[model samples]
Target: MKTQIEQIKVKNFRLYRDLHITDLQRLNVFLGANGSGKTTFFKVFNFLSTCLKDNVTVAVNREGGFKELITRNSDPEKNFIEFEIKFRNFEQGEKSPLVTYHLKIGFNHGKVFIDKEVLKYRRGQRGKPWHFLDYSKGIGSAIKNEQDYDPKSKEIREDQPLGAEDILALKGLGQFERYKTIKSFRTLLEQWLVSNLQNEEMRKIGDVGADQQLSMSGNNLAQVASFIHEYHPDIFQTILTKMKQRVPGIDKVDIAINEAGQILLKFGDNSFTAPFISKYTSDGTIKMFAYLVLLHDPTPRPLLCIEEPENYLYPTLLRELAAELREYAVRGGQVFVSTHSPDFVDALQIEELFLVKKEQNQGCSHIFSAKKYDDGQISELYDNGCELGWLWQHDYFKGINP
Candidate 1:
């Protein structure tokens, strides 16, 4: 089954004391003021991906260690930084059961370790959920032959001990094919993209090559653009055609190699005899093209987390960009976006929007779906000819402080 996250619960992670969000749509947009934890929410995905790629300790350290990473005023001795993601696979078949992956990281004696990590699924509606992989600290076991395991019969297991307490169990067990669920989940984590695109980085010349995926900062935009142009010409042409429609004079986007053999991204204009290099392209054009390249990838990432994509782009183009993001989600990839733009919110459906706000007293963040907020008045306003962005700017989304 194609993997898609249905729900997420986070506890004692930075400003999120206990945030539980359900009924997640394929295209999820987070709207909030600064310090409302929108970036922190995206970091959760980055942290999880890092843990799988490296280790829990490395991930924690990358975020300035446990003290800075955990919630404020929380007792480290008692509380654990926890995350729970409930997702289901649809590629295997529609009958695939919901699967939950839970991880708890604790700090003890100035050292970080996995307090508890679990991946479980119920094969049948009547039976107990099977723990495909279970681990705490460095020791754990995974069920062998999980693909054909019958809950009624005794399940075979193996004691797979990780080299270190901070090591993720999925990092080890995901290698074997027998653990189908674990392997898929691990692959999903490894492929999830969290973009923090820097326009300056996108314009920089880079080594020549075909990079199927975009980097976090999009410094490799030229390479990825080259990749699509060479390997997937149809997709590349679609991107160019879309660009021409969006940008006033953009006729084509091409690649060039400098004398140093570095790849220089180029843009063609209908009025100009010569193409414009990325260095001379406007920020909005470079940023928009980078996004088109990312969204048009033939093999989309299982999950994509992008923060503030409205930056650099013209406000008039935000609605269209938002639509493109939604279309990408419709193509089997889950997307999480944080935006401060009213134009972008105006393009979102109530179910696709979430408001992140913080309590004045508790100083912790909470997420409320736009569909269920304020007794459904937001939906009422939306239905009564009020745009979501206008409602937000006029303080209709209470406590948003935007």
Candidate 2:
């Protein structure tokens, strides 16, 4: 069964004081003007998903944390941010179970405390009582008495930690045996895997590690290409076959480790001969190869979030990339993309697209579903031969108070 994110809600985090999003489809495209908090929203979900993974928390704090991460001037004592995820279970009649996971921290009397932490599971829709794994309250005070005969004697006592019952409940899942499957699956999601793309310069090096998992910055393109060619030969051949259809004369892509242990991509002819260096290859050629390799690799389905995939590509290729993404969605993978390119947005349907805008005075952000608009409004513009981008800019989405 395919497991995919169904919804995400965040509160009191960054530029978002409160945000709720629903109707999550396989392919979600976030479209908005610059500085409208598109990247911030993406970071929220990424952080939420990766918090328990080692090094992710530190990376998130470096980006911004409790001091700089939360809303400004919000109650220092009461400020807390929460994240909730809903997952669709393909085995159970496509029923999606909503999981409300929360992490709350605050400062009190010059000390930082994790005020509340919980992972609650709800079988179905809203109003359903949730089954919880962890829950906590605040610290408690203890009374101290000493030296009953000595009136001047003084003694110190420590306070007990909060949520004893909840802690036992989670720990008891194994020994006491409660909700074993749900607890184990929740742990899996917390440790979800990530694979990234390589950078342009590293792709030129032709090093062994260059074929390593693509870094978030896509700095290891060469190594990734190398790894794909060496180990996953079938996947590599599939990508080459697809790319050949688009770019003529591209017979095969090969990656070789040189005398200095550097990785190199060799583009051969129809007859397939010596591995020519890839540095001489054009930027479009490199980018296309990277996309093909990433898409064809049969790794576990993850939340593939990409930024500005249309960058450094010809207009014709942008349409091709969009079509590829749609095919990816149909294959049961979840994709979230943020783009300013009109060609990218026009390639998707109104239902598959979302327009993000910031609300004034509130300093909060919201997403507008383009599909909610009447069909007549969409058809009228389509019949007039208006492109999706032009309609959004001039007719349907312009001049509405955010």
Residue 114 lDDT in candidate 2: 49
Clash number by candidate, in order: 5, 19
Give lDDT tens digits, candidate 1, residues 349-397: 8899999998879989999999999999999988888989999989998
Q: Which stretches of candidate 1 lie over 4 Å from their true place?
A: 150-153
The local lDDT score (0 to 100) that residue 106 gets in candidate 1 is: 97
Q: Each model's C-alpha lDDT?
A: 0.91, 0.61
TM-score of 1: 0.97
Error of 1 at 349 (Å): 0.8
TM-score of each: 0.97, 0.77
Highest TM-score against the true fold, candidate: 1
Give the winner by lDDT. Answer: 1
